[model samples]
Structures are given as structure tokens and as C-alpha cells.
Target chain A: MKIAVLIAPAVHPVSGRPCAGEADLAALALAQRLSSQVDVWYAGAADDAALADYLARGATHIHTLALAAGREVLSPLAEALQDYALVLCGARAGGGDGSGLLPYQLAEQLGRALLPDVLDLSKSDQQWQALQALPKGVRRTLAAKLPLVASVHARAASAVGWSYARLQQGKIQRKAATGAALPQVVLEPARRARALVAASKVSGHARMQGAIAGGEGKSAGIVVKQGDSVEKAQVVLDYLRQHQLVDF
Target chain B: MDFSTQAIPRIDPRRPWVLGPSGLKRIVLGDDSGSRDAALLAHGPAHKPLRSSGPFSQRLLVVAHAERGQLDDAAREAIAAAAILAGKDGEVLALLYGMQDAAPEALAELAVDRALTVADPGYAPEQKLALLQQLLQQESPHTVLFADRSEDADLGRRLACRARLSVVTDVVEIAADGVRRRQPGAGFSLRERAQVLLLARGVAEAKLPFVGKGERLQTAALPAISEQVQDLGSAASPASQLALEEADLIVSAGNGVSNVPGFLALAEALGAAVGASRVAVDDGRFSRDKQVGATGKTVQASAYIALGISGAVQHLQGIKSCRHVIAVNLDAAAPMIKRADLSIIDDCQSFISAFEALVRRERNLV
Candidate 1:
């Protein structure tokens, strides 16, 4: 019954503090609830200051899979995580070329079953039951065997909030990458991306309303008509002193 | 960006893979477009992996195929976007996975020059990934587009990792040199010259232009791979009683909704279908089928009454086709307020009660 949590870092916009990512922290909380054999692991290099946040949250050991320079991350990280029985990751990351695909790719590489958007995790015997989150408030219970990867959602569990005392107690162990380099790998240039919306005055106008000459206008297309009858004729049901007659 | 109806691109084998005269550089590759012409029909060998012949030019490939046969909405958008980007110089190609028989001829409706249908019926995720890897090795496309799905992202990321290609997921806007996406609250990041771009879950699919060439081809089976996982049937129940996609009137709930019974009652009173926001769905208060958002089903309802929804961008994308919207919630600042024609700021449960009482009184008066 070993559980391992994957860690990614998030930089809060307002505070500029590097915190354990929201989704990852939720996953960590679930891992902590699962067993005492829980370890926090990061795939790439991170500032030690940020890694400290996980130690306080309940992770006893932190393993950093230091990707070799010029090596792709998938092979290296996948190879290193082969031994863990249950691996949990956040649904996505907030910063850096974060595509929210690492967890899925890792599962594919590890040849394990992936249960994504997991809101809760419980085990009985050798089987694991996952309360998975889909769109809306609907939840699905998925059962998978060990050597499984699940992506934890925000609603997974109560996260262990940050504490300075635990941060002082956590220790990090670094592991080197083991992937072999490929021949003739083309180097991709730095991606150039800009905000689609320009800086403008904060106005009361709505985005859907402004685009409305002929296209679907938020206000133009709807008719709110429907089944409209009530059984209020049952005056004896309430038996209340009628405010209109009795008060006088 | 005016394209001339008379401008027909000529293929120059000498100029790499660029389409001449149209000057649009990207080449879209599909599994097989029913192209009988020997040149367009013959792309490369069937079983052998391809090593690209030249430097990269603009090209877009749509990897379309889920467990089922029918193409998904995001896949359609990927094709639509590729068509718009193809213009005259670039080309649109579709890559279909599954067994040889799984590739259908219906792709003629799409605005693509050619499409490649690979024989891969089992619909294994890893097998599809391997086939794509082989095709990519031969073409070296400028940008690879995928329908934003959990598995699609996984496959795309695996390709990116193995190929060392720059990648961006959850993209919305398509630019000349690249694509851009807005980070919530934070401004936006643009990815230029990236090798791969994946559309966010809810990019509005574009309408097709007038005609298509209808060329197609079927390829060999994907490489063998061990399958380890089995998909369990959906969790909880199947979904809501009403199909939100077909419903004309939708009474949607959101996070602010407190009285679940009252909310359902409102929908029943109005004779509208029930819908919920992403958060409401995650709260286990509603069925996944009732969700209306980027990850959920889109509806083109005549009127939508939103209760307690905070109008995240993903949710807004789902309601784009909605005709008239009326929102009720306590916070006037929620994004849904701006999208609604009439917004009432109040507690939603109380509002429903008041409406119920008024409706009964109005019926009596009549």
C-alpha cells in the first residue's frame, strides 16, 4: 500500500510566493490519507525554497528526478517512477510550459492505467476505488488495480495547509536522468505567444454583448417561456393565518 | 486575408513541401483523401518509418479518432482551423486511426486536399501514438493540432517529449506566426513557431467552405503494443433525463446554487432542461451529462436561465449558441452577469421561491 505524490510548483500572481500547486497539493492530501509510505517527487529542477512547501504539507521524502541537460523529460521521469504502486498528480499546472499532459504521458510510458480528475481515493483489499470528477456535479466511481496513476482535482480532499515547522523537517534526494539521447533531434525555438486581449480601461461592457450585430447575442436569442402552473389553490395545506385577512 | 477563388496551388517537389502560387506554407496531411491522382495518393511507404526529406515548412495535421468511429467536435474544429490556415499555399490533411476498415470516406465533406486513413480498429491510445510518431518522422509538420481531450493531450505530449518539439496546449486564438491563449486573471502568452498546438476543450469549430476534393487513402496497421488498462463503464448513473444538447430551454445551476431541490424545482416549473456549471458538477450535485461548459456538451437553446453560475470562460464557450440568457445570483460581478440580458442580483433559492409564488398568483388572476 505505497502511495507517491507528484509535485509541481505554482507562483501566486499576487503574493509572488512559490506554493505547492493547488491540484498537486490536493493529490498530496489524498496520498497522505492513503498510507504512511507516501513520498513527494518532482520531475525537474526547482528552487529548494519551493520544494520546502511540500515537506510541511506531509511528504516525508522528496525525490528530484534531475533531467539531464538537453534530454527530454518523459523518458527520464517515466523510467524513475517504475517502482511506485500508486502515483497521483494534479490535473494541471499553472505556470511554465505547463500543458497538463505530463501525468497522462507518464501513465502511457509506465504502461499503467490512468484515472483522471479523481476527486477522492479509497481502498479495500487490493482494489482502489476512485471518486472521479467529470463536468457538472456528477461523479463517477472508477476501480483500478495497483501500479495506477490518478490525476487529483481541486475537490479531492482537504489539503494540508502550509506550515513553517514541517518545512524545516523535509529532506530532498536528487536522482539523475537515465534516458538515452536520440540521433538527429531537431531543436525547437522558443515559442512566441502574446495575450490576445489588449490592455484596456476596465469597463462595464460584456464580451458576448459587444460582438452582436448579426451573430448570437447573449440577449437576442432566448425566450424564457415554459410550464407555468402552481398548486397554490390548496389553501388548507399551509393552514397559515392569511396575512391579507386575519391580520386585520 | 482575401483568398482568390481562381488561385489554384501547384505542387513543386523541388521547393520542399510548399504549395506554390498560394504561398501558404503549411501542409495539412490526412490519412487518405479519396485522391486518385498517383502523386497525391502516393505519400510514402506503408510499413516503413519515414525520415523527412527537407527543412520544415508550414504544415498542420489533425489526429482524429477516439474509441468510437464518429469524429468529435474538437476534431472537427481542428480540421476547420487547418482549412482556414491552408488558404492556397498550405494544405489540410487528416490522420485517422483504427483498423483499415475504420477509416471512412465521409471526410469528403471537409475542406481538405487529401486525408490519410490508417488501419487501426482497436483504437488503442499507444498504437495511435506510434503511428503518429512514424508519420511525423516523415513529414516534420510545422504545427500538429489535436482535438482537446484527455487522451489526445496525452498522445500529443508523448510525441512532443519524444520528438523534442515545442508545445502549447489549451490554445484558443490562431495567429499568422502562431497561436495565443489567455491565462485567467493573468494576461496572455503567445506561442510562435511552436511545433505543436492543441486547442483548448471548447474552441468554436468553424463552418466549412463550399467544396472539397474528396481524396482518401488507407494505411497499414499501427505497430503492436501491449494493452494494460481497461475502461470501466461511466461512474454513478448514465446522466440526466434530458439531453442538454437538444433541449430548447435550459435552467442551468452553478456553484452559488444552495437549494438543490429548489433549483430542480425551478427547472421543472419552467419546463426547461437542467444544466449545471463545472463546479456544480464537481460538487456531485448534478450529473456530468447536465454540464454545460468547455469540457461538457454545448447547447443551442432558445432561452437559458442561469442560477448561481460564475461564468468561467470554459462555461461561456458552451453557451455561445444560446439565444437569450437570464442569470440570477448574489454577485453582480460574476462573468455570467455580463452575458445575460437581464441579471438579478439576489439569493437564487429565494428568487426561485418568489417566482413560484408570483407564477401561482398570476395564474389565479388570469
Candidate 2:
């Protein structure tokens, strides 16, 4: 069985700088878990080096389906997924396309079962057992036949231990697929009306000073004392309250 | 970006394919209003009972995890209201799980055609899923409506996948043939058609009448189903560090509340449970479980104090069960002020300090 894991590199919203978040790590973890049975394929919008990192972990091959400049399209990637026995993607991309609708749209187009926000998965005799999270920690398990699409949530896969030797020895080769024609949709200009207004007001000297002071206080290091249960509990509660950790 | 020339698969316009079996089965997931105090702050005084506006042409199934203590009367009323709404056109089957004991007669009074009681025997997620899937398969629902949250979304998606049907999430509006999903892009709503419609939100703005003229339904004891899985003796143990349902007084903060950390002291001072708005939860200021909104826990408490919460419709829907509401926000135009019994148009932090001091002074005088 060839399991294709979809990958979308996380990008910084403000700087457009490429990075990785918990979702990428989660995909990598899930791919590693499934590597024992099926040949894992990593298909993503990343450069050769970045793709190699995933390949080193467990992927058999790396396929890069970069979005063309001036186009916000997902057709090329969706079409390429036709060959895989089971296609898995993150529920939502971290940056630019953060709506988490890619898997849904792809499933609709392909006319296949689309499982979004899958939390648990187990395979037996070519059948897949998946657990879904419901409201209030309630979960439901489902069985699906092979050749399905799963959009993994952040909590779907558990954290896997990484090996240094695997990272060093992994060879990542990029194979490009035939790109689909870009959809003809009118692109709207990016809106920054709120940010612009906030920026202008914060540009003043006194305001900047106050912000700097606040930032410093926010980042202050925590001090812990040994064997002080009451004080420790107080610290924890205070931290949670100050940081809005609790419900209130 | 464009659907104009995408060569979208052209289904026969005259003969549209309808998925799922031909059965009048409906799955109704009920949220316990007494589970969290934030529900009272989020939903306010206008306690709109859950009711079905459209024609209910299916086997009605109601599901809820039973609450601790004497079940809140208002919460039971809400569930009863939902049951009545669901039973408007079909037989109502209720599956109440995670309860200390079975109350079948009370459920029957609430118009339950059949009641399945699962004991609070500490079933794991996988175990619960298996049982739920089995139940769903045994009684297939044409429509499934669950609370719009992470767990429900997961279950709904998985169920849809297994049933070979389309699943839409974050649906804020529901109708007969389809649902209106709040799309990602700014304020856009998508109309989706499906055989099995999973509603995250039932018909918006529809008021359901309170059940039984506020009379308490008599409890009917029933034997628990014996389904041996793994040892469930320890499963009922409390997993969360905090139990919001047991809290009488709650102090909830929102986006407008500055110094999020300061609220802890206030909670401690007033002997109140702490809660938060959806904004704070999304901002990583609090856990999603602690969030009080339409998408979060429904809280019913004696006194719900709102700090900087503006009381949006979504937030209001979650906290409508609170008896006494106190809002402290700087925004005079905030909807919370209008809904609150005592609206203080002041900084939340300052209000907290004053309230704490006043409480302290009263205690000292006593």
C-alpha cells in the first residue's frame, strides 16, 4: 500500500518566511507511525532540502507540488493524489491557506470519503480503524476501506521520537508531477485595514515605551522554589489566570 | 479562487444523486448546560429552548452525558425542550451515557420513545466510539446534529466518512434540505446539500417553549446495559483538574479584559470558578475546554460575572441559564451591559479589585 502524506510548509504571516509548526510535526509523526506497513510518500509544497527532512524520517519518496507564482490553486496537488492507496493531509495549513477546507474540497472533487479532524487511526487486514473526537472529549471510532482521504487534526498523532542517524542518512529526491491549469478566479486585494490603524496609533513615543515595558513584563522568567506546595500552587494559579490559562 | 471555468463535474441536473439510506432517522447531540459556568455567562437570560423548526422526518435520537449533583432543573428543561422539538414528527429514542444511575421514566416523560442508558463505567475513547458507531449503525439517522466543537467535529467527520456521506462543520444555520456553513473568508456562508445533514447549530433565533410547564419530571429507574469491555471501574475518575459544573459562582473574562493573569486572584477572592471567552481560548490564553460560547461549554451557575465580554449572539447562546449576571466592561455599548443585571462600564481589572476589597471588608465585618 502506498500512503501519500500531503505536506504544506508553514509560513510566517507577516514576513512570508518558511517555518514549521505543530501540524507539520504531527504529519511527520503520523507518517512515521504508518511507515511500518505501507510505503510512505511525502507530497508537499517545499524545497528539496525541506522535503529531505521528511524523507529522512520515513518517507520512501518526496514529490513537490509547488504552487505557481500569482496563483492560489490546489488542483495540481489534488489530481496527483489519485495514484495513492490512502491520502492523508493536515486539517489546515498553518499560513496563507488557513481555512482547513482543502481536504473537503479535494474529496468533493474526487468523489471519495473525506474524514476531517481524525484523532486516532489503526489498521488491520487492509481496513483502517479511525477514532474521531466529539464535543466534551467524546470520541467515535469508524472503519473505512482502503483508498480513502483523511485530514488529520493536531492531536491525531502522538509524538514520535526522532533518530539522529535517520536524519543524517535520509536522501530526499524531488519528483515533479504534471501541473493542472490554474483556476480562473478573481483574486481580491489583501485587507490590512485593522492592522494599519493599530500600527499608526502605536507609532507614538510614549505608547511604544509603555508597550516595551509591557512586553518585558510579559516575558519575565518564572522563579520556582522547592517543596513549597502552597506557594507553588499559588504561582501556578496566578500564571494560569494572568495568561488566561483557565476558563475565566 | 474561481468556480466559473473549473470544469466542475456536471451531475445530471434532472437526476441528482442522494446519498445514505432511505430512513427517517435523526441524531440529536445535547450539551449539558450545567457542565460549565461559562454557559450562563455566554447564554444570558433569554433561555431559548432547543426546538426543531423544519419538518422532522426521521427516527429522533437524543444523546447527552449526564451531569453531577442534582441535575439542574433548567438544564433538564433545555434537554426536554430539545426532546420535544425532535419528537415533533417521529419516535424519540434517547441514549443517555456517563450517568451515575439510569432515569428512564423521567426521559420517557420527556417524550422519549425509547431510552438507552449507559452507566458511568469509565469507558475509554475507543470503547465509547465503538458503542456509538454500533448504535448509529443499528439506528441509522438521516440527519445528525452535534454541538460545534473539536470532539463533535471529529466524530461527525469520522461518522460521515464511514457512512459515505458529506460532512460540513461549523454550521451556524440549519434548514430542511441543507445547511449554511460559515465559510472561512470574511462573513461568507456556503449552502451545502447532503442526505445526512450534520447541524452544528440548529435553526438560529428559534425559541423553544420550556418543557412540562416547569414541573420536574419523575425519575424512572432502569437497569443498566451490561456490555463487557475493558475494566471500567476506574473510568469514572475525574480527569480534569477543575470541575466547572460544580462551581456556584463563576468569574469569566473575555478579550476586553486586560491583564488576563489578574483574574485568578479575583476568582480566588470571590471563591468563584474562572472562565473565558472564545477569543481568549483561541489566543492560547486558555484551553478550548474552558471557552464559553456556542462552540464551547454551556455553563449554568447561580451567579455569572462577565469581565470584558461583549456578549455576542454566539457567546450569549452558551450562557443563557445564569440566574444573576454581572458585567464589567469598559465598552458602554457592549451587548453584555444591556443583558447584565448590574452593568459596570469600568475597567475589568479595577472592578475586580473593588469587588475583591468589598468582599474582604464584608468578611472582616462578619
Candidate 3:
């Protein structure tokens, strides 16, 4: 089965600093874990160098969708995903529109079943079984037919190991793609309300010394060192009180 | 064709039962029931001063799922602290849920003007939200308070949005018309407003106290409704999955814990459940169920060992209630280090390996 991976680059405010999004890395890692026949798609602001790197890693094809600033457009990408059997995206983007609502909105737009926060995915009998993370380390399994959207949460799987051999033989192709019309919402630039008034610096020596003292004090477990039972009990009470363990 | 002419039942818009200002009630929404009850007892009665002060006659609502666990002393202290803050201007009412008989004890311990028990079968998130929403709408409370990490955060957000009110999340300090949030970010500074407020835990204004005693209510006599609703079931599902109140030990990891090499071994060695930070789960390092944070799960283990976590405000809010926090990190400056009972500034991998080795050696010696 062919898989399409969606990626958006992270953008920094003020300095306009550029960084690869953690979500992209997560999606790429998942794509690598699937069968080698998978293809990759890049949406919004991915430079050629990053595209080449993804190609080197095993992406069969890279599709780039050009978007202007402040577009807040997503429907075009959702439309482009129509051809793919299974669409994979990050549960949340790290920077620039990292609302964590994109996947749900996209799924709704596409009218496809969305399995979110999926930890493990396996394919059997033309359907995919997903192990979803519930609260408190409990997991629930869900099954969806092919051509569904899976927005994988960051902790869904281990990072895929990179290999030099795969990098050497991998093919890279770039395709120019058009997205659906940009949504008509006007976005006001984020305004800064406060400025740093003062900054304090602590000497490294003082920090190190403090760390040493803290380490020593912490290593001595169960502060009741006295052999006398009453004294030990008093020490325990003192310890609890010092730590604010009990409410009076 | 004439359907529009059907007379709507005459609803009394200003019925005295609805217009009379309900006593200012405070609810300690927390994961810990025992602590919540203690807090109600400690500070619930003192809130009577608000009636004399005027403009603060709203009631307090404490909502939490009972099946999750009993509130401990620390949670009670937090509630007491909130009660003290709420009492500065209004009458306090306490609502306690969870366990078979928490209502009467809560009613007795708290200076509750009236006690309402939302029985077990009716224990769903939507039901709780709907019931609270109905109460708040009817009472028109000046403020609604909730523990920062409780499942009620979602409810608080929805209520605030629906009611067109501003909510102050993760509040550590609260005063007359002013609130201080706990962390650095947007809306961290003290907000001054007489408008209806929803205060979350960890705000900078008040120090959460730790209590030692909790009241156990009589469950048999409390009013109950048994009709099950599916929406409420989903909302309460997340809280019910946690066994933290009963856990003796918990081993939690964060995004910094990249691989799965040591998790199983640590869980086996410590006989503890494995937990993860929201960042860790978002990075695909673990499942969402393992996540512990504001948007995740709350744990009250006796011993909590944190591995490679920086302890962001959201994550810290959930685990701060744990009895002991043992933090292992390479960075001594990580927030978790400051909060930890035992802070180890060493490689987490080495510590995990050493812990496993020590456990194995001890087992062999036995």
C-alpha cells in the first residue's frame, strides 16, 4: 500500500528563525517504519535540502504545495490526499499553527475516519489495527479500513534508525502541486504585551556548589537515622513537616 | 402550517427560587477525595464572612470522580487554601463525590448549607458538567474554582466559552478580584477582575497547603440517579482508568527518554506503573495513556520517580500531589529537580541501569 506523509516546517517568532518541525520528524519516522513501498508528501515551507534528505531516507516521491503567508489554508492539502490509500500526519505541529486541531478538522473535511493518538499500527486483511493510548498507561485497539487518516501522536512509536545503504539508493523526485483555495479568515499578527524588565544571573560556581549540597542531602534517605524509636518517630514527623507532606 | 402558533409554556423568568442569590458555594474539584473533604471541613465554615462583606454570595462547587481514588491530606490542604480564598467574599458550599459514602462526611465536615450527592451510576463527565452548568446558571456564581489537573479543566473551558466568561487556568494565588497564575507564559501575570472567574491550580497567588486528615461521608443515604448517558461515560472514562490513589510507586518518563530500553525493566524492578510526559507522548515515544500533565492524567502515587523530565508547568501540575518525587536528569536546572524530594543530576540511562542491577543483586542475595 502507498502512504503519503504530510510535513510542515517550524517557524520562530520575532527572529523569524527556521527549524525543522518535530512533527515532521515524527511523521518521517513512522513512514520509514512502514513498508519500503511508501511515498512521502511535503506541505508548506519545506526547502529542497530537507526534501533531498527525506528522499535519501526512502521517500519515493515528494510533493510540495506552495502557500503564501497568513493563508491559514488546509483544504487544498486535504483535497490532495484524496488519491492516497492512507494519509499520515502529526497529531500536532510544533510551530506556526500548532493548535492540535488540524488533524481533526482535516478529517472532518475529508469525511474519513480519523484515529488519533495512535501508538502502534499494523495491517492485516486490507485493514489497519491501531493501538490507541488511553489514560494512565491503558491502551485500546481500534480498526479502520484502508484510506483513513491517522494523526499519530509524538509518543506513538520509537524513532526509526537511519541507514547509509538506504540513503545511497533512495530516489528523490519533486512535484509541484496546487492546493484548494485558501480559507478567507483574516489572521492578526500576534502582539507582544510584555517586555523583559530585568534579568538575574547566578554564578556557575554557586549553582554547582548548591547542586553538590542538594545531592548529598537527598542521597541520605529516610531521615530517621537515630536508633531510639521515639527519636526516630520525631525525626520522621520533622521530615514530613519540612517537606509539607501533611496538611494540618 | 399553524405550528408556529403553539403557545410555549409560560416560564417564570424571575421565579424567587431562581432569583434569590444562592449561598456562595465552593467545590474542591480534585482527584483526591479525602483531601477535598478535609479542605471543606477546614475552610468551608469560615467562608461565612463573605455574606457580611457583600457582592460575594456565590456557592462553591467541588466536583471529582469518586471511583478514581480518595482525596489525601495534601489535596485537602489545597482545597482548604481555596476555601480560605473563596471565603474572603462569599458563603462556601462543598460537593464531594467518589466512594460509597463520601457525601455525608463531606456535609458534616464542611459547613455545607446543603449537600448534593451525584451517585455512581450518574457519574459521567457530561452529567457532571451538565449538572454543574445547570447549578451555575441557576446560581449565577461570581466564581467557579477547579483543581488545575482535574478532568474538569475541559469542562471549565467549555463553560467559560459557552458563558462568554474569562477563565484563569493554573492559578496558584487568588485574592479579592485578583489571581496569580503559576507558570511563565501568556496570561501569567495577575489579572484583576470582578467578573466571574474560573481558577485553575498552580497560580502564584496562594501556596497550596498539605493536610493530614480527610472526612469519609455516608454513601447510603445520598440521593442518586441511575440513568446512564454515553457522552458522560466518555468524559469520565479517562479518570477511571487511573489507579494512582492506590499505587505505592510510579515510574514516569518524559520526552528526554527517547527509547524503550529501560522502561519495562524499571517497571518490573520497582513494581510500579509507567507514566510519561505529554511531550514524550507527543513525540511518539510513548502512548497518550502514559502521559501525565494538565491535558493528561493525574497520579497520586506514594513514590514517583521522574526520568529525564524537565517538569513543564503542565506536567508538574499533575504530579505535584505525589508524596515523593525522585527526579533523574542530566540538567540540574530542570524544574523537576527543584521540586523533587531526591534530585539526581546524572545520566538517566546510567541510573536506570544501576537501579536494575542493584535490584537484581538484592534478589540474588535473598
Order the candidate numbers by TM-score, best to worst.
1, 3, 2
Q: Candidate 3, A136: how far from true, in Å? A: 5.8
Residues B272-360, candidate 2, lDDT per residue (tens digit)?
77788999888887887778878887776656778889999888877786645667677777778766655556666666665565544
True contacts kept of each: 0.10, 0.02, 0.01
- In terms of lDDT, the best-performing candidate is 1
> TM-score of chain B, candidate 2?
0.44
Please identify which of the two predictions, 1 or 2, would achieve the higher lDDT against the true structure.
1
What value does the lDDT take at residue A131 in candidate 3?
A: 67
Error of 3 at A40 (Å): 3.1
Task: Give each prediction's root-mean-square deviation over alpha carbons.
Answer: 16.3, 20.7, 19.4
Evaluate chain B of model 3: give its TM-score.
0.44
Residue A175 of model 3: what lDDT?
Answer: 49
The C-alpha TM-scores of every prediction are 0.56, 0.42, 0.45
Q: If both were scored by TM-score, which would come out higher, candidate 2 or candidate 3?
A: 3
Error of 3 at B276 (Å): 18
* Candidate 1: residue B322 lDDT (0-100): 69
Tens digits of per-residue lDDT for model 2, A119-222: 66678676776665433233556566766777777766644445556667655555554445533323333332110010122224334444544432222333
Full ranking by lDDT = 1, 3, 2
Model 1 spans with C-alpha error above 4 angstroms: A65-76, A108-113, A122-131, A136-144, A173-213, A216-248, B1-59, B64-76, B95-143, B149-151, B158-167, B172-195, B201-226, B236-264, B267-303, B306-366
